[model samples]
Target: MTELLSLSRAARLAGVTRAEIQKRIRHGEMQTFEGQVAISDLLRVYPSVSLEQSGDFERVEQIKAEAYPRSHDEDTRLPSQQVLITRIKALAEALVQRVARVEALEQLLEEVRARLDEMAADAGDKSGASAAAETQTHTQAQALRDLSAWLQTRRTDLAESAVEAAQTQLLARDSFLRIMSASVKMIPSGHEFFVDGNESILEAAVRSGLRLSYGCASGNCGECKARLVSGEVYRLREHDYVLSEREKQMGYLLTCSHTAVTDLQLEAAEAHSPADLPEQEIQAQIRKLEPQSGGLMLLHVQTPRTNTLRFMAGQRARLRLADGPEQELPIASCPCNGRNLLFTLRQGDDAFSQAVFETVTPRQPVTLTGPYGDFVLADATEPAVFIALGDGIAPIKSLIEHAVSIDSIEAFHLYWSVPAPRMHDHQPWCRALRETLDNFAFTPLVDAACDDLLALLESDLEALPDNRYYIAGPGSAVQAVVSTLLAAGVPQARIASEELD
Candidate 1:
């Protein structure tokens, strides 16, 4: 029998994204059986990945250290004791079933041996039986002996194969991952993510960049209610909203208050586009204001815990300071963390930008509303090119982060052009992204002309018509890039642009 692994687990074990695995399958480099890869195939394709020193396991650790250094505490790598015990019990039951099957096979083998011995004895009693019958009995006994020997040898081969050290270690690592995190598969949309630590299902979904519908994250409004289709869950908090008896009978639960105890499948609502998200007004507090290069300010704000902002990445939000007019600015942070949002503000003569740049202190109250824009990423698996110019890097940054969270894009190429004086400001970040993501490339252009930018894009991309393009910059620059792409036979529907001016 062939040992098979799910695509998600195979990707985790191989230390690559699921999209990378799918790409290989699409290119006929790898094979799958019913959406699962054979363990032998996985090992063959990712020979560099193993549990040995400096292998796939260590590569994963390195990525965690670099990309998500503050993701969780070291002590929290294990699941809760109760959940751990349940998993162990499940494993034990599977072991018991296998053992019973082995015993039954042994008994059947003993019976076959006894029957062969009886046949051999009958063959020797030639006086009472015909000569032809005796000859047939002896032949049957010899054939049975040979078959028994082959079965025993085959069983030994299977036993040795089952204990292959490298594959054994791979499976052990997968079990360890299960202990640390539980996978969740959303129904209808078929989206998936892992629930790390003891975070609620809603929290994990949002953190994974899936825009699941929700109102109050504290479970007061029951907007996060979902029917449990499979897996175990534990309530992390008590919710005041009572479920109908019929809903309760159907396993309805509040995702905001429940944490997954095992891999789960739930019928949950998700926002596929910006239009799916409702208009929300959140009174957030200014977390901090950090000055960046080229007269730009990084404004950090934290929304209330109960009411977090719900929006897609690369969208704009209207922010207003006390006694100041609202200013619409592109959000510079990933939608993964709606509670703590970031905005990139150019410190121009505008009142809102000046207030944020000069006088906005930490914990200052700010009115945040209107996650307004249609400049969100498409739900396609094609390669994407992101072009950001100067301060326009804000929205592009959010889009890149969101794409990384989803880990579904086939490839990504980022082109960032800033004035000569501010060229070095974002280089460090671009370098980090290049080091972390296997499918990402970054090119920096300092005060580049339109020809220079277009030349780089033409040289970097394999095909212009096949990939999606997203551009953010001054209105004139964005229009120029868009026109060039359209003239190059790129479809208008494959391009998305945001004017930063």
Candidate 2:
């Protein structure tokens, strides 16, 4: 039996469109096994199939071709051949016309030379030839002037031809701009214009001096994604083959591919660059490093000089490990604790982890910088749901503690997930939640044994009665969870999620 691959993955591997892949499956050209198609079937029948082997090789080649086809000799040669044939035909016709014109000019020059030689022979036989010599000199001067005039006419024609060529190039450029401008719309909201209409949002924004949230602009990366409140968007190119049907229906546009058809209202949920963030350095002592279940370590750092280090909860800081270089990490603790700074670190016994455990003793000096990330607890009175996975628990933990301290949050729920072993080790944090929080619920998933987290929430969503949801996790996991939540009827406006990377 052949291993199955998703339709999107198969499309990527087969160098065909996802729509094409689906068509093939429907047409019985390829067979779908499980939620994916058999690689063998795709290899056997894909029109552009080059690789006999399976796995990601076919997709890799497709991507390379798309990115750099010019580097391939065969690809370069084909286009060059067509262009060469067209140029050769044009040059051949021009050369033939020039040759015929030159032949006619040569015959006319021969007639003039023959007439001059006859005149010279007549002058040679003259008895008093001074007057004849003067007449011949005048004739020769007249012929030289005629030749100069002819050369000037040819030069004028060449100049005119050069000007016409330049005008053609200018017109071509103008046409390109007009075509591109039609697909792009520029909207000015306040001092800054919100450019949402263009499919190439980043390119448009950058051209206009507006910075957008993007990591890899390629569609596969999902870095430049945005919610389109109202508009029709078309995808040009995508890096990743996966885009859920529900996301499309809900008007969630990947800014990379989304060109605006109608005027749009977009709420960008991305972090401001580090240059925009306030910079500060703080001295703190590592008071305790308690092991938490699920490979999470609860770090309590004491800053006695300052009762509280003013920083954002989801913001990260740099901790100079005792042996290794400084490690930059985000703050996990809620802002409620003034003097004691709390943070959580995911452990794997890596160099940084080893330095924290073996080298850095409690009460050791540590330097922290940040209150970074734009992920913050919104100042809304409405109840919200906080969903977190893996180390993503850090930000949710901060927001929750802050809400409880301010008495601003009336209702909220926290969902945290990690491996079973890590969960077991960090049971105390869960115990603390069970003991302290009255209105909140802490439901931790041992592993990703479940299909969807939002589905689990839907079973009791009505009970919580909160419309807002904040989510953070690894890029892929975050995308899966967000798609699942949106599919479950959560509005795009109500859902806030961030991928740290």
Candidate 3:
């Protein structure tokens, strides 16, 4: 028999009213295993609920069905939206408080320094009290050290708080702007507005129903790059090393990174269709997990639902592990046999990978939270070439499979490379693809034994009939290929790639 919880107990654990729990249960919206509600159901209804209660748990299938009859979906429930908005607001407010605290601490430090100066001045005037002066000096130095350490800590806190504030603001703003921009009218004669204040213009714009172009949303990818038509944008974080000074001077601002100090009018470089940005979540069972090579694992995930996942070939998903924290891993291969989803995991010596390989098990429930990334083959008309190194072949493989599935027999070539023949264990799949997919050619570049990878890329470019190129691989390899492509006269805009580092 399932251990049952009364409505009151479930409500208390869920941080909701007993009436609400009864209403949901009565409506048959929530599932109870043998008349006992699972703690997990409460969590789905109230994600922010404290995890202090311990017990066996059941999963809730549809909170909205029982809780809010008019709610569109469980994800769209007021509780979930409230959780997101409240958390975002709280984060923003906390950042402001931290900044204020840091400023106050700095002022106190200055005061302490001034007091020490006064003490030093008094000590200088006393000649006969030399011993007392020395003792006082030592005490003052120690005090100064303590104050300095405190100040440093405060500064660090302030820096961290600032980054948090910026990130929260960006997310909120992006969410708002993307929804807004979809329906807004654009003026034929572009209007310029300056971005002023620490408030996120993107968020404001999003809230106002404008969508903006952005990538990584972390300021690392320049996909959100925009020209500051006017006004100054003070960057809150110093991690945007990806953007060059010249780019900044050119008024190029990363919407995710820049806050407007002045009212700013900027144009979005990319526009996405409404259907392209649907929010989706996938539940899957861990079917198989095996070590493919050193530090890399081949993961086969199976979803029970027959709903087709319409994702672009090169797009990536956020994988929420059953045992470990979430990770963003690219779908390394295409969906095979219309049943299994495939991905490659290169175990970087991180806590995430260690948990996945060493601790996570098959039959575990994993959730995927995405279909993000515009690195796919967006235009069917454009003749394209694909390049990948090592496990970077994941996205390329997706694109190829998608292209073949759609009967797009356009001129497509794949150049895939691994360290050696031993690492080419998955090469049989590549050969199979080439054999089945007409108009598709594969070039396998093995290390040391063949012509240099870069040289081969250059030669391939020479023979290509004016086509766009997509490259994905390690940072250095991608850069080398991009440089070669750019030097070989391919337009920068036509050369699309993603650096996962």
Candidate 4:
């Protein structure tokens, strides 16, 4: 029997994670003997693998130059065969990029069609098909038809792109043509992982057995927010969060929908305990229901005092309605009052939201579980910045209250973005707080629409650096503002995010 290398050795030799080695094995990209692999087989599978290539193309050139001393007969240092291989690898990368662009275009086109349909329906409802309205409707219908035709055109373009890709056919031996991955450096612990061309940061991290806070893996939940300390990244999917320009400038990102474009440095907010959270469902009751402006409800809930749940401020819990399925919501009350909890949920036609606002009367029986999340305060004296939108203001309140009453902080700033003055219920409270608390500043950002959210935070972003940031909102709203913050270069270590879905 031939001696074979273990999975550990293969991972080490190939400069990849153990999960990556196993994945390649499952795909039959790397051959194995018995349950182990041969060194020759490993090298054959990864001909151009390197130990985190930061400017390594030059290193390869320098190594080649040092091996073959300069000669008078040949001015070109690269051999014809090597040059051809290099060109092929570059072409492969270009093909991958084109495919990605095509996929993004297809998704965008779908969104455009949906939006146009929605606009057409809304317009018809409002205008009652008047002459001018009918003309507009006709134009919209024509645009929709044109869009359908454009989609087909794009499909043809994609086919052409595929044909182009097929011309530069690749072979297993040409592993150098494999797509490149961006290396990510996790601050504080300094652990490193590579985000493959198709892998999002959260996916890569979790796959590699690293623990970070995340929720709903889908774009709807803004749970996987991190700070892109440095380097470029590209969005892989539509994000629900709307980020302010200031937040974009600060470097916040939702790791579930974005992929690293270059060697990166990121900061992650992770759970305090390494072990998985043990969820225990228990009996609870609706203690109070305070109606806020618009379709928002401030629901107060309380579990049995005997079995109090422990969770960080800004953490979330699942609220089970009498006639509805369970809904995940952030606790508006801090952990100081664990058994007695307050929650904020939007009033909607859905069973859960409706139950909270109308059906579920005070003192009604309910089921509750959790105190789950890693959106607690950072252990720093730096100024804290909190941004809350719509019902997302719930968890931010818990954090803000904690900062004022429990923990000692250097300073803190709070920006509340709401649609109208009727929704500005907390203005007087926050203004009074500013007068009483020397370290606190509150800004009421009325009429702050999703697209222009960060405009209110411009001056604050310029003043705050390496300060703790906590954002709570609908996933899309959170993602948008977080992306802006990340683009603004906010260190990921100082940011924490959670979403109410």
Candidate closest to the true structure, highest lDDT: 1
Quantify how close model 4 is to the true structure by its C-alpha RMSD in Å: 28.5
Per-residue lDDT of model 2, residues 1-501, tens digit only: 244555544554454444456556666777776547765565467533433333443443333223211211222211133333433454456558867986787677667666655665554455555787867765665665566556656656855784444433333332222222322232322112222222255444432223355544456556566666644344544557365788767656667555433224554543334354345566778998887555567787776431234454455667765444566666776543324666777666567776775576788877766656667766554666887877777777666655543333445677777755555333455556545444557777766633556567877578433568888878788888877766666778777776865
lDDT score, candidate 3: 0.56
* TM-scores, one per candidate: 0.89, 0.42, 0.43, 0.44
Which ten residues in a row are the worst by lDDT in model 2? Answer: 68-77
Cα displacement (Å) at residue 372, model 3: 1.8
Count the clashes in each prediction: 0, 18, 27, 34
Identify the runs in model 4 with alpha carbons over 4 angstroms from their true place: 1-277, 449-458
Query: What value does the lDDT take at residue 277 in candidate 3?
Result: 56
Model 1, residue 498: displacement in angstroms?
Answer: 1.7
Least accurate 10 contiguous residues by lDDT in model 4:
68-77
Predict model 1's lDDT versus the native.
0.81
Query: After best superposition, candidate 2 residue 59: deviation in angstroms?
Result: 59
Collision pairs in model 1 = none
Q: Per-residue CA lDDT of candidate 4, range 1-501, in tens?
A: 233555644554455434456667767887777557865566567665444442423332233233222211223322234333444555567669877987897799778767766765655556656798788777877676677667767767866773333322222212332234445777765555655436567766653334466655556656677888887677767887766677678898888777766557898865455134456577888888888777777787876643545566777888887766678888776554456677877767777876666667988888887767777776555678888876678889878765553323556788888756547665665776576554578887865664565555665555544567898877887887788777767777777887766
Residue 289 CA displacement from its true place in model 2, Å:
2.3
Q: Residue 55 in candidate 3 has what lDDT? A: 26
Give me the runs in candidate 2 sitting further than 4 Å from their true place: 1-277, 292-296, 322-324, 424-427, 431-438, 463-466
Looking at candidate 4, what is the lDDT of residue 269? 61
